[model samples]
Target: MTKYCRYHRNHGHTTEECKALEEKIEELVRAGHFRRFVRKDDNSFRSHHPPRSDHRCPPCDSRHGKRLNQPANHDPQPARTNVTPVDPPLRGIINTISGGFAGGGSTSSVRKRHLRHIQSINHITHSHHRRRMPPITFTDDDFQGLDHQQDDPMVITVEIENYAVKKVLIDQGSSVDILYWATYQKLQLSDTAMVPYNEPIYGFSGEKVSTCGYIDLHIIFRDGAQTKTIPIRFLIVDAPTSYNVLLGCPSLNTLGAVVSTPHLAMKFSSPSGDILTIYGNQRLARECYMASLHPQLPILQTNHIERPPSSEIT
Candidate 1:
């Protein structure tokens, strides 16, 4: 009688000499599944082997394979175990084992790393939120004797880049400092000196204007015995304006300045704890206001002819 091959279910050869069964065993060993096929009677067979140095877990090497130690007949379905399944395309299964998908590390060190990251973000937010200047209180004496009936905007001359620039308006309603293109060119600054500015500015009339660029320059302000020099960033725009420059709220806030329109003066505390005051030039303010309105005013021409023209027409 011919010996039967148990693996291939053929009568041509015995199971030990079956080429198909040998190939199947080799495939199972390579896949790390050879232990599942071991017979119970084979007590001398060793199912698990120590992992080679290169095959050990990169994160923590407690086992040979990424799979947890399981019984030989354990179910293959994922729902049977609490272990999360790892994506096969990924390099290793340690990501699932360490719980890295929950926005943090799998081990104690990883958790510490995540905690540090969160703390850094919180610190930055707190720093920005807590930034505030000291109390800035104004008194009646801050605007002594300069109060007069006037409807002109506050205008002054300030030293910029060592040059006295006239027609500089102090506007508390403005959010950013502005330098008109004419004034910028008068400073003799080249195009290469300007940095790119992405923000746009809108006027009171709701007209939007794109900025040309921006430049940083030192501006010097004087108030009798006290003088303050600050670096001011001016957004350059090529629009027709009566004023050469505008000092807005940003500069005022940085200097802790307070403006009194009725007195045509501005006051701030100096670094040396002295009160610094700068009075506006009332005449320049009125002139700039008139110039701003000149383009909008209509022009009318009157012509008178002699009486002889009327008699000749009749």
Candidate 2:
């Protein structure tokens, strides 16, 4: 069945569902054209309908300039109970807007602009108390376990899915986290679990490194009893690398970790709000660098020295 809009004098949507008509009605109401239709009390019309207490507009994605569909199970923002009474001008305009507007029916650029204008006028901002993280400062004692003589990268071990993954290099300069093909195979992760990533990453010499895919894995950063587990999306690359995984800026920043090369340690806040420092294996770091130079050489494995307690530090 074909529907026609008499307002537009065209086929497709009905006259009642016509967006242009609704916009025109809203504009006329705002201009005091429909003074008789608007009730003397703006709250009277709203009291009966009570704008569905449960309904909420999905958060706007600034990048896309559109509303993203959220999952059914997704937690919604707390419904604002202390909503201020709408101004007469806005209430009059709202009275003319079709029921569709309230239920996300019409999403024209004009509608968006009008809604934004209304939101700006009646926006309620809720203030939240932010939890302050303890100050992370590296002292000379942070270097007690390391050999500062060698210019080695920050290489350490992090647990992945409960497995102690060794030869993980913490590169603060790297933008993306990387998981080598050899390590991926060792993890016994199904290839189907990998989400396809097409963008090629460039190396120092402008060489393109082909990516297999990317996977979000929970990696455990531990310093004795203090542990921080964060999900990291590691780009799987079929490249020759001595390191099993490379921890980059994305994960480091998320974990609030600070890397000090001179100190040969990575420090991040623990769940208990105390600073937990993970000391880099200086011996393993030099070995990994040497292995990178000699790809033919077998990857050397070593015992991961568990970081000593903070009390033991001088």
Candidate 3:
């Protein structure tokens, strides 16, 4: 019922059926089209079209083999990838280091040091408010003034100070010492007395939990080899952690212990010895800080509000 056009006149068909008929003819032609240039070399066919709009192999572009341009489904990440890949050389070195990793027997620390030194130099020279803290060197005098502590059984030696090493946690972030009831009941600590913190305590998972009671415990520690004991306030936290005791900043500060990333341990000065350095790690801190910082966000904090009154005397 339709008329034929010049394009399909050779096909002996009307324009309505020309499209189907033309497709068959062009498909036969496209194979020859492919053989013509594809065998020209091994890489691929060089038959590309000019910049006009209708630039495509008529048969190849038709619905027979052509597909619609559908978008791919991308996944949204909840957090970091679950796969904790092995750390690179830098991370490995930091990992293997235990007790203390004061310096290298180790990584290409020289080159690494040089790079860091250059970076530090550049930063210091360019920055307006750059100040470096000098290293701590404790002589035999500043600590000699304190009262001497007596010997005890449960104490272990880290350095000069004697710390009581019970089945407890030595959290350096707490002001009041913590003691779990189970640990207390086990140790038979006095004053099963209750002093409750109405506020909730959060764990690494950030779940709120209740706290039970507070107890006073004697802590013993060692230096070089000598052991001693010190009385400390112990608060009971009702959490499921194996950490029966939590030692906070106040407790650490009272004992004259200093925590540094370099040593990766806690150093405590014993009453019997010189300034003793204990090592602790910062892996949690590193991971937490990294998790808190979005890749697109700037690390520096900016304040536009007015400054507070100066505390320094004139």
RMSD each, Å: 24.6, 25.5, 24.2
Compose the digit string of candidate 1's lDDT tens values, residues 95-159.
11111113252256776887787788675677666555545555666554443667768887777
In candidate 3, residue 245 scores what lDDT? 49
Query: Which digits, one per residue and each the tens of the lDDT, describe model 3 over residues 100-192?
Result: 111211245654775577678665686565643334554443232122231111111221112222323344444355555555554444553
lDDT at position 58, candidate 2: 45
Provide TM-scores for the models: 0.50, 0.54, 0.34
Of candidates 3 and 1, the better by lDDT: 1
Q: Which stretches of candidate 1 lie over 4 Å from their true place?
A: 1-147, 296-314
On lDDT, the stronger of 1 and 2 is 2
Error of 2 at 56 (Å): 92
Q: Cα lDDT for residue 39, model 2?
A: 77
lDDT of 3 at 34: 37
Off by over 4 Å in 2: 1-132, 302-314
Point to the candidate with the largest lDDT. Answer: 2
Tens-digit lDDT track of model 2 for 97-166: 1211222222466667766765873453533433456788998777755566767788888887656777
Off by over 4 Å in 3: 1-168, 190-199, 202-207, 277-314
